[model samples]
Structures are given as structure tokens and as C-alpha cells.
Target: MCQLLGMNCNTPTDILFSFEGFHRRGGLTDHHADGWGIAFFEGRGCRLFLDDKPSADSPVAALVRAYPIQSENVIAHIRKATVGPVGLANTHPFIREMWGQYWIFAHNGDLKDYHPAPGQYFRPVGSTDSEAAFCAIMENLRQRWDAPPPLHELWEEVQSLTESIRAHGIFNFMLSNGEFLFAHCSTHLHYIVRKAPFTTAHLLDEDVTVDFANVTKPDDRVAVIATQPLTDNEHWTRIEPQQLILFKDGQPLYCS
Candidate 1:
């Protein structure tokens, strides 16, 4: 299994503090260490970085740790390689284009003996079931509608596809198109939101601490979702299995 990290904010925000701890799970503090990748959505464009090397020590990962790339939506993954060969080609956090927007996806669980129907619209560039699953969803979305559907409509369709895939095994995943961030939990998943009257938080994997009040505006709000809680002091909410959440502007959009 892999680990996933996602951030959705009302305004552009850097994920440096959170990523610093999360990336260590790729090799140092934990043992996910196969390959890693991250994508940050800035306006209509996205900045992405990937490496086959262990994220804890990859030179590219070092550079990412040095820079504070700001974005409104971001998704990242650290892989453990259950189905595919450990190489750059099989990395998670795969990207594709849809509805004239870039879509990023990252999975955190493995499916058992999964093989989706052959698709005429989208295909996977890698051999992992994770990639195949992503393609399946994208293909379905493309075939179901010519343009991006309404958020609630899209959510229902995605929720169905997500459940179908989860039938084979775990289907925890995060997806974003620079507009909405969708997270579906089939196994373990947790999230926390920070807003005005922010407090200090200490990373569970590191001794580092950050006081949000010192750096963020009063109106700033951020929602972070992960396979596990990244900070020990935060009140992280565990997302129930089979639940799908649609997030925007740093909060979950509840659909009635």
C-alpha cells in the first residue's frame, strides 16, 4: 500500500510544513519507499514532480523541500509497490487531461486481481492496477458526458465508479482538477481543517512545529486529507469507509 496527502485551501498555500513530514514516510520514518510524486494546482496550471528514487533522499525531493510551491489544490503519493515494478514508469500520482483541465490522481490501496474493461477513450501508461483504475474512471467520465458535469452530478458518477472499483479491494484515493478536490475512502483516511484562530501543530514524524497564526491571514482556511494524521496535536476526523467527499475552498461540500 501507498500513502496519500492532499490539500485544498481557500487561497493559494504552500504545503511545505506538511509535506516535510509526509515525505519521510517514503523511506526514513516509515517504509513506503518505492517512488514518489506530487502535483500542485496553481490557477489553471499545475506544477508536478516525480522521482523513482526514495523520496526521503531523492535529490529532486530535496529540491522540493527547499522550495515553497504555493497552490490552492495539491495531491501527493508515496508508493510501496504492490503490483508494478519499482521504477519511474510505475509511480503514483498520475496525471491526465479532461474537460480541458489537468486532473491529478493518487491511490493509497491495492486492488485484488483487478482488470477493468478495455477502454477506447483513456488508457494507462503504466502497469499498476492503480493507474488502470484511474483510467477507468476518466474513461467513464468522458463517455458519460462531453463536458465537465455539475459537481453533484460528477460526485454521484464518481462515487459509483469508486464503489465499483472498491468491490475488488481498497479504493482510497484523491483527485483534483484545480477546481474541486474529491476524496473517497475505502479503507483508512483522515482529514483536518484549519482556519481563523489557528493553533500550533507538531508533526508526528518530526520534532518540527509550526504556528499557523504567525503566517496565515485571518481569512485563510485549509483542509488536509491523508492516509493518517500528519500532526499529533490536531483533531483529525477519520473519514468513514465508502464515504465520498467533495471539497472546495477548504471545506467539504455536503450534497443533499
Candidate 2:
């Protein structure tokens, strides 16, 4: 299986510190080294980077590690290659245009026999069940509404669709559209919110540390969600199994 990393902040923020630990799982700290990619959402536009190489060894990954691109919503993934070949098109987080926004998706689990009916509007560029699943979601949305639906309705629809997909196999994933960040936990997931009076954090996978007090102001608020905890010091809240969470403005919006 692959892994997921997501960030939702009240203000534009760079994910270099969290990404440093998360990227290592692509080849160094863990074995999900097929390929990797990330998308950073800034206003209505997004900066997406994909590499069909192990993130630990890819020069492009090195550049990203050094660059300080800032955004309010971000989604990233490191693949283990269960459904598609190790190539650029197969890498995630995959991006699509919908309702005048760039929708980003990243999956952390494998599905079995998940072929959806062919459609003219939504189709997969890569032969991965993950991409197929993304297309299916978009197609369903497009068929039901011409514009972005209400957040509550969208959450219900997404939860229902995710539940259907989980019946096939594990369906843990992260999704975002520059407005809201949605995360579903089929097995393992955790998150932490950093706000005023933030403290230092030590990366569990790398020999790096960051003191939030030195870099952030008194009003900055940020949320980091991942398949696993990235830091050792912060008390991350573990997501309950089979739960769907939507995050916006650094806070969680749960479906009722």
C-alpha cells in the first residue's frame, strides 16, 4: 500500500517540515518506493509535481525539499505500485478540473475489481484502480450537479461512495479541492492541529527538528493529517476506523 499526507491551514503555509518525514517513507524509512507526487493549492491555482521515481533518490524530490512553496490546501502520496505500472501517469496525488477548481486525490489502499462504467466526461489517464476510482467520483458528481454541491450534501455523497468502494477493499484516502480537505480512514490515519503557543516538533523518520514558535505568529493555525504520525513529540489524534472527516480553515467538519 501507499501512504497519504495532507495539510489544511488558515494561512498559506509550507509543508517542508512534515514532508521531510513523509517523503522518506517512499524509499528510505519504508518500502513504498515506486513513485510519488504532491499538489499545493494556492488560491484558485495549484502547483503539482509528479515523479516516477523513488522520492528518496529523485533529484526532483530534492528540489521540492529545498523549495518553500506555500499553500493553504495540499495533498501528497508515495506509491507502492499495486494497480498501475511505476510511471509518471500512475503517480499521485492525481489532479482533475471540476466545478471551476482543481480537485486532487491520493489513495493509500488497494481495491479489487473496481471497474466502473465507461463515461465521456471522466476517464482515467493511467490504468490504476486508484485513478479509476477518482474518475468515478468526479463522474458521479458531474452527473448529479453542474456546480459544487453544498458541503453537507457533498460530504454525505462522498461518505456513501467511499463506503461502497470500501466494500471492494481498503479505501483509505485524502481528497481536496482548494476549499475543503476530505480524509477517509479505512484502517490507519492520524492528525494534529498546530495553533498559537506551538511547540517544537521532532521528526520520527529523519534527524530534523523545527520550533514552530520561532517561525509562526500568535494567530497562525495549521492542521496536518497523515497515514501515521510524523513527529514524536506532538500528541496526534488517531482517527477512528471507518470515519470520514472534512477539514477547512484548520478545523475539522464531521458529517452528521
Candidate 3:
């Protein structure tokens, strides 16, 4: 299985603190070390980075840790390589264009013997079930509507499609389209929301601590989602099995 990390905020925010701990799982603190990647959404564009090396030691990962790239939505993944070879194309937080927006997706679990039909427009460049699933979702959306539907309606279709896919096996995943982030929990998935009166928090994998209040405005809100809790102090809400949640402006807008 892989590990997933996601961030959604009302204002553009850097993921340095959380990613510091999450990236450790790619080889140092945990064992999902086959490859890793991340995507940060800035307006309608996305900055994507991928590497076939362990994130804990990759120079690209080091750059990401030091850089303070701000984004409204972000998704990251550290892979353990159950279904595909250890390579760049197999690394996730995969990206594709849909409805004039970049849709980012990352999966954390395996789907046994799952093989979907070829997609009309979107297709996987990698030989992983996660990538196949992503293409299938995009194909479904492309076939369901002539254009992008409203957010709520779009979520409904996403949920239905996700449910169908989960029937094959474990399907925990995170998805985002710059505007909103959608997370589905098939197994382990947790999240924490930080807002007014933010407090200091320490990382579980490192000795780093940051008092968010010192760097953020009173109105800023941030929601962070991961395969497991990243901090040692703050409480993280564990998403229920089969649950799908939509987040915007650092708050959950819909859950089912």
C-alpha cells in the first residue's frame, strides 16, 4: 500500500511542516519507499513533481521540503509498489486535464485483479491500478456530461464512481480540482482542521514544531488529510469506512 497526504485551505498555504513528517514514511520512518510524488494547485495550473527514488533521500523531495510553494489544494503520495514497477510513471499524485482544470489523484490501497476497460479520452501512462482507476473516473465524467457539472452534482457522480471501484478492493484515495478536495476512505484516512487561535504542533516523524498562529492570519483556515495522523499533539478526525468528504475553504462541505 501507499500513503496519501492532502491539503486544502481558504488561502494559499505552504505544506512544509506536514510534508516534513509525511515524507519520512517514504524510507526513513516508514516503509513506503518505492517512489513518491506531489502536486500543488495554483489557480488553474499545477506544479507536479515526481521521482523514482525514495522521498527521504531524493534531492527533489529535499527541495520541496525547503521551498515554501503556496497552494490552495495539494496531494502527495509515497508508494510501496504493489502493482507497478518502481519508476517515475508509476509514482503518484497523478495529474490529468479535465474540464479545463487539472485533476490530481492519489491512491493508498490495492485493488486485487482489477482491470477496467480502456478510456476514451483519458488513459494511464503507467501500469498501475491506481492510474487505471483515475483514467476510468475521468472517462466516466467525460461520458456523463458534455461539460463540467456543478460542484454538488459533480461530487455525486464521483461518489457513485468511487463506490463502484471500491467493490473491487481497497480504494482509499484523495482527489482535487484546484477548487475543492475530495477524500474517500476505504480504510485508514484522518484529517485535522486548523483555524482561528491556532496552536503549536510537533511532527510525529521529526522534532520540528511550528506555531501556526505566528504565520497565519485570523481568517485563514487549513484542512490537512493523510493516511495517518502526522502530528503528535492535535486531534485528527478519522474518516469512516466508505465515507466520501468534500472540502473547500478548509472546511468539510459534504460528507456521505
Candidate 4:
């Protein structure tokens, strides 16, 4: 299994604060350390970064730390090499095109002996079950619609697709199409929402602290989801096992 970090906000926000603690988990705090990637969505486009090296030690990560790329939606992953060989292609937060928009995906669990039927519209570029599952979902969606459907309808379909794959094994994952963010927790996941009257939060992995109230606007709202809570002082609610939540404008629009 790997680790996942996602952010959805009402306005564009930089992930540097959360990423600081998360990157350390690749080799310093937790030792997943195989490959890592991150994607930030700006309108219809995405800025993606990937590396086969440990995120903590990867030279690519230095640029990530320096660049304050802001986005309304973001996804990141650090691999632990469960099924795929270490390489850039195997790094996660995989991206694909669908319905004239880009989609980003990342998984944090293992599917035992899972294999998917070949898809005409989408296929895994890498040999990991995570990517296979992603392609499967994309293929299924493409089969169901020629164009983008309503958010509510698409959300239900995505939820159903995820439920079908849950039988294979642990299936915690995050998906986004820039407009909405979906998170499914098969085992463990936690999320925190920061907004008006924000408070100071301290990273559990690093010796850094941020006073969010001082840095953010009064109306800014951001939802941060991770395999584990990144901050020690904030009250992060654990997403119940097997529950799927859809977030929009930094709010949980639906949960099931």
C-alpha cells in the first residue's frame, strides 16, 4: 500500500503546507519510498510532477517545494512498491482525458491478484493494479456516456464503479475531474476543512508550523484529505470505512 494526499478548495490554494509533512513520509517519517507524484489542476489543464526516487530525496521534489503552484484541486501519492516496479510510469496520481476534461486519480491500497479486461478507451500505462483499476473506471464511464453527465448522476456512477472494485481488496482512493473531488475509504482516511477563523496547525512529521489564519483570507475554504492526518493540532474526522464522499467548493456535498 501507498499513501495519498488530496486537496479541494473553493479558491486556488497551494499545497506546500500539507506536502511538506507528506513528502517526509516517503523516506523519513514512514518509509514508503519507491516513487512519488503530484498533480495540480488549473482550469482544464494540469501540472504534474513524477519521480522514481524517494520523495524526500528526489531532486524533483525540490522544485515542488519552491514553486507555489496554486490550484482548486490537487492529488499526490507516494508509492510503497506493492505491485509495480519502481519507475516514473509507476508513480501515481495518474492522469487521463475524458469528456474534454482531464481526470486525476490516486490509490492508497493493494488489490490482491486483480486483473481487468482490456479496455478500448483507456488502459494502464503501468503494470500496477492501481492504474488498472483507474483505467477500468474510466473505461466504464466512457461506455456509459458520450459526453459528461450531470454531477449527481456521474457521482453515483463513480460510486458504483468503486464499490464493484472494493471486493478485490483494500480500495482507498481519491478522484477528481477539477469540478469535484471524490474520496472512498476502504480502510482508513481522514479529512479536515479549514475556513473562516482558521487556526494554527503544526505538522506531525516536521518541525514546521503555520498560522493559517494569518496566511489565508477570511472566506477561503480548503478541504485536505490524507491517508493519515498531517497536522497534530487540528481535529480531523476519520472517514468511515466503506464510505464514499463527494466534495465540491470545499464542502462534503454527499456521503454514502
Candidate 5:
């Protein structure tokens, strides 16, 4: 299986700290080393990076760790390649254009016999079932509405589609369109929120800690979601199986 990481914040925030520990799982601290990719949403545009090499050793990943690119929403994945060949096109955190926005998606699980019907507008460029599922979701959304719906309505439709897909196998995933982040837990997922009066958080995979309060304003808020807890000190809430959550302004707006 792959691993997932996502960030949503009330203000633009860099993910260097969390990513430091998360990327270690790609080869150094764990075994999900087939490939890696990440996307950061800034306004209407998105910055995407991908590599078919282990994130722990890739120069691209090193650049990302060194650069503090701030974003309101971000998605990242480190793959173990359960379904597709190890290549650039098979990397997670795939991106697509829809409703005048670039949507990013990343999956952390495998699906069995999960070929979807032919899509009319969207299609997968990769061989992974994860990419197929992303395309299917886009196609379904396009067919269901002429334009993007309200956040709540969109969540309902997406939740229903994900439920239908989960019947085939695991479907843990994260999605974002610059404005909001939607996370679905088919098996394993966890999240943590940081706000005013923030305290120090120690990374579980690295020998480092950050006191967010010193770097953030009083009004800043941030939410981080991952396949597992990333910090050793802060409490991380586990997202239940089959649960879907929508996050905005660094807090969960809805859950089902």
C-alpha cells in the first residue's frame, strides 16, 4: 500500500516540517519506495512535482524539503506500487482540470477488479486503479452537474461515489480543489489540528520538533491528515473506516 499526506490551512502554510517525516517513509524509515509525488494549491494554480525514484533519495524530493512553498491546500503520496509499474505516470497525487480549477487526488490503497465504465470527459493516463478511480470521480461529477455544486452537496455526491467504489476494495484517498480538502478513510487515516497557542510537536520519524506558535499568527489554523500519526507529542484523531470528511479553514466542516 501507499502512504498519504494532506494539509489545509486558514492561511497559506508550508509543509516542510511534516513532509520531512512523511517522505522518510518512502525509503528511509519505511518501505513505500516505488515513487512519490506532491501538489500544492496556490490560488487558482497548482504546483505539482513527481518522481519515480524513492523520495528519500530523489533530488526532487530534496528540493521540496529545502523549499518552503506555502499553500492553502496540499496533497502528497509515497507509493509502494501494488498495482502499477514504477514510473512517473504511475505516481500518486495526480492532477486534473475541472470546473475551471485543478483538482488533486492521491490514494493509499489497492482496489481489486475495479475497472470503471468508459469516461466521457476524463480518463486515466496511468495504469493504477488509483488513477482510474480519480478519473471515474471526475467523470461522474461532470455528468451529475453542469458546474461545481455547493460544498455540502459536492461532498454528498463524492461520498456516495466513494462508497460505491469501496465495495470493490480499499479506497482511502485525499482530494482538494484549492478551496477545500476532502478525505475518505476506507481503512487507516488520522488527522490533527493546530491553532492559536500552538505547542511543540515532535516528528515520529525524524529527530526534529517545531513550535508552530512562534512562526504563526494568532489567527492561523492548520489541519494535517495522514495515513498514520506523524507527531509523537500532539494528539491525532483517527478517522473511522468508511468515513468521509470535508475540511476548510483548517477545521472539519462536515463528516459522514
Candidate 6:
């Protein structure tokens, strides 16, 4: 299985600090090193980077660590290659255009014998079950609505679609359309919301510490979701095994 990391903030924020620790899971701390990718959503567009190399050793990953790219919504993944071959196209954090919006998806689990019907509007370019499932969701959305629907309606549709997919196998995943982030827990997932009165935090996988209060404003709020906790000091809320949550403006709008 792979691993997922996502961030949704009320204001644009850089993920370099969190990713600095998360990327180590690619090969150093863990073994999900088949490939890796990330997407940062800015306004109506997205900045995507993918590499068929371990994030722990890839030069591209190092650049990402050094660059402070700010985004409102972000999704990242380190793949272990259960379904797709070890290649660029098989990297996680797959992206596609839907209703003129860029949607990013990343999965952390495997599907068994799952083959969905081809969609007319949305389809997968990569041969991964995660991408195929994403395409299926988009295709369903395209067929159901001509334009972007309300966030609540979209959440309902996504919840139903995730339930259907979960029937096949583990379906832990994170999705975003640059507006809101959706996370579903199949086995393992945790999150933490940081806001005013922030404190120093230390990474569990690395000897790194950051005092967020010194660097962030009083009104800044950020929600980070991951397959596992990234830090050792702060408390992370563990999501239930079968749950779907929608995060907007760095807060959980809905959970079911």
C-alpha cells in the first residue's frame, strides 16, 4: 500500500515544513518508494510534480522541500506499487480536469479485481486502480450534473461513490477540487487542525521541530490529514476505519 498526505488551509500556506518530514517515508523511514507525486492547488489551477523515484532520494523531492510553494489545498502520495507498474504514469496524486476545475486524487490502499465501466467525459491515463476510481467518480459527476453543484451535493455524491468502491477492497483516499478536500478512511488515517495559540511541534520520523506560533498569524488555520501522524508531540485525531470527511476553510464541514 501507499501513503497519503493532504493539507487544507483557510489561507494559502506552504507545505515545505510538513513535507520535509512526510517525504522521508518514501524510503528512509518506510518503504513506499515505488514512486511519488504531489499537487498544490492555487486559485483555479494546480501545480503538479511527479517523479518515478523515491521521494527520499529524488532531486525533484529535494527541490520541493527547499521551495516554499504556497497553496490552499494540497495532496501528496508515496506509492508502494500494488496495482500499477513502477513508472511515472503510475505515481499517486493523479490529476484531471472536471467541469473546468482541476481535481487531484491520491490513494493509500489497493483494490481487488475492480474494473469500472469506461467514462465518456473522464478517464484514466495511468493504469492504476486509484486513477481508474477517480475517473469513475468524475464520470459519474459529469453524467449527473452539467455544472459544479453545491458542496453538500458534491459531498453526498462522493460519499456514495466511496461506499461503492470500498466494497471491492480497502479504499482509503484523499480528494480535492481546489475548493474543498475529501478524505475517506478505510484502515488508518489521522489529522490535526492547527490554529491560533499554536505551539512547537516535532516530527516523529525526523529530528525537526517548528514553533508554528512564531511563523504564523493569529488567524491562520490549517488542517493536515495523513495516513499516519507526522509529528510526535501534537495530538492527532484518528479517523474511524469507515468514515468520509469534507474539509473546507481548514475546518471539517461534514463527516459521516
lDDT digits (tens) for residues 25-143 of candidate 3? 99989887798999999998899999989999999999999999999999999999998898988989899998788899999898988899898899899999999999999999988
| Candidate 2 wrong stretches, greater than 4 Å | none
Poorest 10 consecutive residues by lDDT, candidate 3: 142-151
TM-score of predicted model 5? 0.99
State the weakest 10-residue window (summed lDDT) of model 1.
Answer: 247-256
* TM-score, prediction 2: 0.97
Give a tens-digit lDDT track for model 1, residues 94-178.
Answer: 8999889999999988899899877888888889999999999999999999998888888889988887898988889999999
lDDT of each: 0.91, 0.90, 0.94, 0.92, 0.94, 0.92
Candidate 3 Cα errors over 4 Å, as ranges: none
Error of 3 at 256 (Å): 0.4
Report the error of model 1 at residue 104, Å: 0.5
TM-score, every prediction = 0.97, 0.97, 0.98, 0.98, 0.99, 0.99
Q: Which residue pairs in model 1 clash with each other?
A: none
Model 4 pairs whose backbones collide: none
* Per-residue alpha-carbon lDDT of candidate 2 for residues 23-142, written as tens digits (9 for 90 to 100): 999899899779999999999999999998999998888988999998999999999999888899899998999888899999988899899987667899999988988998888888
Model 2 pairs whose backbones collide: none
Candidate 2 lDDT score at position 78: 91
Per model, how many backbone clashes are there? 0, 0, 0, 0, 0, 0
lDDT of 6 by residue, 1-256 (tens): 5889999999999998799889999998998779899999989989999999999999999999999998999999999999978998888788888888999999988889899988899878889999999999889988999999998999999999999999989999999999999999999999999999999999998899999999899999999999999999999999998899999999899999
